[model samples]
Target: MRRRGLAFIIVALMLGMLLAALDQTIVSTALPTIVSDLGGLEELSWVVTGYLLASTVSTPLWGKLGDQFGRKYLFVTAIVIFLVGSALCGLSSSMGQLIAYRSLQGLGGGGLMVLAQAIVGDVVSARERGKYQGWFGGVFAVASVVGPLLGGLFVDHLSWHWVFYINLPLGAVALFVIVAGLPNDKSQTRHRIDFAGVVLLGGATSCLVLLTTWGGTTYPWSDPVILGLAGAAVVLLVAWAVAERRAREPVLPLELFRLRAFTMSSAVGFVVGFAMFGALTYLPLYLQAVHGVTPTLSGLHLLPMMAGMLTMSIISGQIISRTGKYRYLPITGTAFATVGLLMLSMLTEHSSLWTMSVDLLVLGMGLGMTMQVLVIIVQNAVDFKDLGVATSGVTFFRSIGGAFGVATLGSVFSSRLNDDLSRVLARTRLPPGFDPAQVQQDPTAIQRLPPELAADFLHVYADAIATVFKVAAPIMLVAFALTWLIPQQQLRETTKAADLGEGLGATSAERSSLAEVERGLVRLADADLRRGFYARLGSLAGLDGIAPQGVWIIARLDGKGWVEAAELACRADVSRATGRPYVDQLVERGLVERSDDEDRLRLTGEGRVAAGRLTRSSLESLRGLVADWGDSPQLKRLCERITPELLGARADRPR
Candidate 1:
């Protein structure tokens, strides 16, 4: 494809991503106004909870459907659903109507985020994807900062309804650009949709989300409704697991959990999502209720955190791209997050805005280091065939985590606030018509209260919020521990051909040529040149017995961190039958060992040492090759311009 066309498609996809991302926070600042207008203050939580429930349940389904039916048309369909739902939300006459419409919007919104990442994976090489994915992190940061401000502006000037209405023009523009720019290609392979699996998984997710949202809030933890939902969730989850094992095409493959990186990364993602979302959701409440800031001012105050996140995300991407090592980044990030949360727990009603800003910045930097890299890690770990499912799987866990975190922490906050308020109010003579419920529901209402009463309310809220943060700080420490368990895998230089196969409209002959060119490039960039350098270094390092094929296998194992024998065979372009002899050879030579389950292969300690030496040798060789070209801007420019052209020319060739 032409550069202009690819650029347009990317912009369109980002806009689509922005639409969903913005909606997650846009209504938050507008919620009080929405409740005032719609007269359903009691049901206010449903407005947010409904969207989260629908989106979480639908995320994996959209990915599976896109993989089966092809992404272009399905993605466009999602945008249309979102637009229609947005329009309906704007026109809603009641809070119940808005909540129902938001669920419909979530049905579409779920697709936007996962599909955007999958599409980028399809088009860009993993080597270059880090930089591109950094842009996504930036978009998310900007949306977080902008969404509340936009919601506040709309509520204060136009109406709370305009928050929903604003999506119309943006959605239309995204729809048009995507339809015009993205290629529509259906898969030739017949896929059986896992109908039973979908139903079971959806039910399980909905039940779990409901359990969290309602537990200790709408109902007691021991209430029959809450207990029933919890029981149903467990049953549905187990049934879904059984269904996946039997289904020909599972929506969420059971086998992915066998991979250590995928499992650990998913767990880490969930915890991070829980901590970040839980903190972000309530931080504004703290600022407005305790510090007496307006919605717009609270939004503006969040800028330092957003800036910290954006700066670190871009820097982390560059570091990962240049160094090809990402395991320690998340570990460091989690450390920062733990410290930040601990500091936040110490905040008092008298704490200055500058102190709060510094705390948030630390938290943002920690999040920046982990969030995007987790996606990249999982993408690099899985096979191309499972890419869509793997991407959506991580997203699914994160979304569920956010829902669970918010409910759990919100419950804690509510309970503490009520207890503290009651105790404080018992000691003082109350002002007439000063309803605690009204003041709690609307932070702005405190401004109209007697000054002495308002100060007490503020102090109560501040102490309660601080206790919530103290409880949350321990969660970040758990995330930090999980980060250490993720083994580092080298990022692949090329995108998997299987992922890009049908989407870009290349003919058979062009595909073959493209494949040949890509293989040649890989050999030049990864294997042949590196092996030659390693050979020379191996002799000096007393590792002279390794063959080129053995080295190739070692490289593959190192790149994947650990892979099942069948998957490793597929990656190395050999059938399982043909690959067995090679694996036997490696095992006999003591260079590879089977994991405890005896289903996967990983390098032995000796093998790891050998691999590290080879990697270092290769880097040294590349540096030597480029040594003479130092300080020459033209050489760098030429390499950049020519590399993509060499790759793109084969795609443009005629059949």
Candidate 2:
């Protein structure tokens, strides 16, 4: 494909990915206003939890279906569902309606995220995959930073519904680009849909999440509803296991748990999601209700944490990509997260925003370190056949953990606030018509009370939030310990730390083994391509005087054996006059020879020898990058497969 056309396709994919990632965080700052407008504070966590649960459960299904049926149409279908869901969410009149719509949106969001990333592997060459993957990470970082602030802007200026409505225009643009720029898919794989496993797993997960969300706050722990949910969760879990064992393709293969690395990473990822999303869900409430910050200002105050996460995630990914050492990251990351949670638990109404910002930054740093590292650890440990499932499995656990975390932590916050409110109200008198229950359901009701009464209510709110973090701190400690249990496996060249973007975005795209390795090598080989990297490869190939452009011409000749001089110029997007100099340079260096008509060029024996040398040099560079994989025949074949692309034409340079 032409470079401009390919770029458009990538842009479309990134837009799709951005829409899904943005939704995850955008609703956090809006939740306070949403609760105020919708009048169902008890169901507040469900807003985020519903989306998380639906997206999590649907991810693997989307992945498998895209594999069975080509991705092009499926990608379009996902965008349509997401946009429809977004429109419905904007029109919702109640919290219940909104939650339901958000789940529908999540179902589409899961497909958008997975298919978008997977399409990159399909459309882009292996050598450029790493570079594009890095761009995807940037998209996530932008979403994480901007989502909350954008949500707040919409809510404070317009109605809270605008938060969902905002996706409409973005989704339309992405849909247009994807349909116009993407080619029809030609590949398909046959596989069972695992309907039984998906149904049982979804049933069990919904039951478990509801149990956590409702057990104490909505109903007493001993209530029949709560007990029934518990019993149902257990029975469904057993049935799901049985179904998975018998299914031809389980939604989550049970055998993955046997790999200690997969098990440990999944566990740690779960806790990380628990603490991260739980805090994201509540911190805005604390800022808005207790500190009296506007929703927009509340989003601004959360920047410290987002900054820490983006910075540390990029830094850790770079370190691992370069040095291939990551065992320490998760352990230290969990330690920081635990400390950060404890710090957050210490906040009271009197705590300054600066203090809170510092605490959030610490927690964000911890989360950043562990989130992507766990993905890498699992990818490295799994066998080739399990690579896709294993990677998605880790992500699944983290997402489910977030769902449970928000629900469970919200329950704790609600229970603690109820108890505190009862104790304080029993000893004090309230203004006429001011019901204590009103304050529990609507935090904004505190502002309507007298100054002294509002102070007491704010203190109760602060205590409840602090207790939420307190409950999460120990869970993070368990993740810290699990990091120790993750065996230290050598990082493969096929999987680079730079893929932290996919991990950060929490996508569930499953790549084949060859695709995975190609992505890592392309990232390493092309890391410095813009800064004369081709020239460096030329020098490595013993072509000392060749410019990067000359290197391009030689590689073109090497790949095609011969090329019409005018055709080469046209492919390079340059005039024949401008491109002739590079071809002349290769000819002068005896790496190419003119055809009898002098209108075409082909590599000479010397040129072929230089091309062979370049191939070996490129392979050696990749081999060194994955030295831990050893010099086996399998490694050689993989390197051979990758070298041509690495030393092939540079799309950005003159041929």
Candidate 3:
């Protein structure tokens, strides 16, 4: 349709994306207050971990469901589920209840993020979709930067409950706009979803997360409960492997492991996720509890990290795009991450905010450099048929890594803090009737103590956080070691390194090989156009006489083959009277011809030659987008297939 209608649809989709993306980071700052209100400081990580685990497991299911069914109503259902979860979370009275609700919310959040991207393929054509996909990616970047700050604002100024409640109004607006503006899905393709694999994998992951979360903190290492979970984890993992091998469409194909690149990327991705999530979860506690900062200021303190991550991600992508060599990035990235985590481990209650900022910035930059490149490496490594699954698989490992990271590190923090608190509380005298358990459950309770006692408790909190990072640092070193196994692969011309948005907001939307290429090309084209792309392309095509609009007309006719002369002006978005002169000029230049009846227009022999030249020009310019990728037959064929569509009238426009 109309531009207005498309605009509304996009707005609604963006809002849905924003809600899902925001929830991922918004709760980080709020976690402190949430624990203060609900008790169970030991369970703090689960609030984020539950959401992550649920979302990661559900992503494949949602993607397959949307394909088997239609995305429109499924997306609507996802929004409803998300809203309901948000409502329940806001009303939760216990840590357990909040964690469960967050998981429920995560189920919908997965759908929202995946479906929103999938919906774009439905609403926009391949040639023009690149720019729209970029917009969606942009939504993720904005969410990453704003989610924490917004969460802090709600927790400090409003109630912590408002963090979840905020989704209500936004979800309602998105729901309304989507229903009104989105078209009905007419797709009938069916897919066999790997239900058994999903179930087994989910069970396996849950067992693993719980084992890590409770191993030292909730139960002794030798506790039967812990041992049983370990046994269950191994058994479930074996079962999942069997299910994946037998299933027609596995959640994560076992065959991917055979590819050295895929295996290495997944390993590195997992470690990055582990470190990134561990930091995101605990840094706020350090700020609010140890540094005595407000929730909002804690969020503000995170900006240096965000800036560093975003900056390095872009810089790394551009460098890869230009050089077409990326093996060194992961190696460099992991090194930075290991050092950063080590730096973070050194932080104490006496540390300055400036020192923390530098440490966080370094960590963010390292993660930013590493995370975005993994997907690109996987995409280039796998066969075309594995494109979608490979892309999602790498990110899937990252999410799982994050879950494990938070749980594992949280266990470290809880164990250390409890031990220290027990020993210190026994030696020091407290006011009559003050319960030591209160201090164990809430760091804020330390402020109720005498000044000297409170300072000691803050030191305990600070030391525990430091130990968490200390444990995390070596894990990143493992990722650094794993990166060496990733053999340097040639960057295919069609392989576009993910931009800041896609890198930050990793989505599970599966597209065909050509579709992926087209999306990347369109994004490259949009970026190029802003820098006088068409003029350069026209010069390359030897059409210096034609304006950019004229080049568009030539491409339009070439793509359509022929068009009714009477409809040309409207298709061109110009008036018939005003367009006649332009048509005559093309005819005079021998680039176009009128039919015998003069009611239709078609490219002349000379016009066809110009179109062919223009196609070559388009391909050349596209190659320029990835500067160093040498010429290839595959690149030429892809460029030819999409150039006309890229230059023609948008497929979604009103006829």
**Which candidate should be chosen as best, given TM-score against the real structure?**
2
Q: For model 1, how does the per-residue alpha-carbon lDDT over 1-655 read when each residue is reduced to its tens digit?
A: 5667878878888888888888887777777567656765445556766676677777656766776788888888889989999999999999889989999998888788767756765565533444455565456666766877787778777888899998999989889988887777544335687889878987887787677666786788999999999999999999999999999877779999998889988887777777766776677777777777766677677767666666677677668767778899889988998898899999988999999999999988997787767766776687655655676576666666666666667677777777887898789788786667776666556667788878888788789889878988898899899999998875654322112111110001111112222332332343333235334555644566755455556656763466887876655566777666666777888889988876799899888876666565544443343333243444334344333322212121111
Q: Write the per-residue lDDT of candidate 3 for residues 193-282, one digit (tens) a residue.
A: 899999999999999999999997789899999999999999999999999998887888899999999999999999998988888889
From the highest lDDT down, the ranking of the candidates is 2, 3, 1
Model 1 alpha-carbon drift over 4 Å, by segment: 1-11, 32-46, 70-73, 92-95, 114-138, 176-189, 380-388, 489-655
Score every model by TM-score. 0.71, 0.92, 0.91
Estimate the Cα RMSD of every predicted model relative to the unseen true structure.
15.6, 2.8, 3.8
Can you list the residue pairs that collide in candidate 1? none
Clashing pairs in 2: 494-517
The predicted structure with the larger TM-score, 2 or 3, is 2
lDDT measured at residue 541 in model 3 versus the true structure, 0 to 100: 86
Identify the superior model by TM-score, candidate 1 or candidate 3.
Answer: 3
lDDT values of the candidates?
Answer: 0.69, 0.85, 0.84
TM-score of 3: 0.91
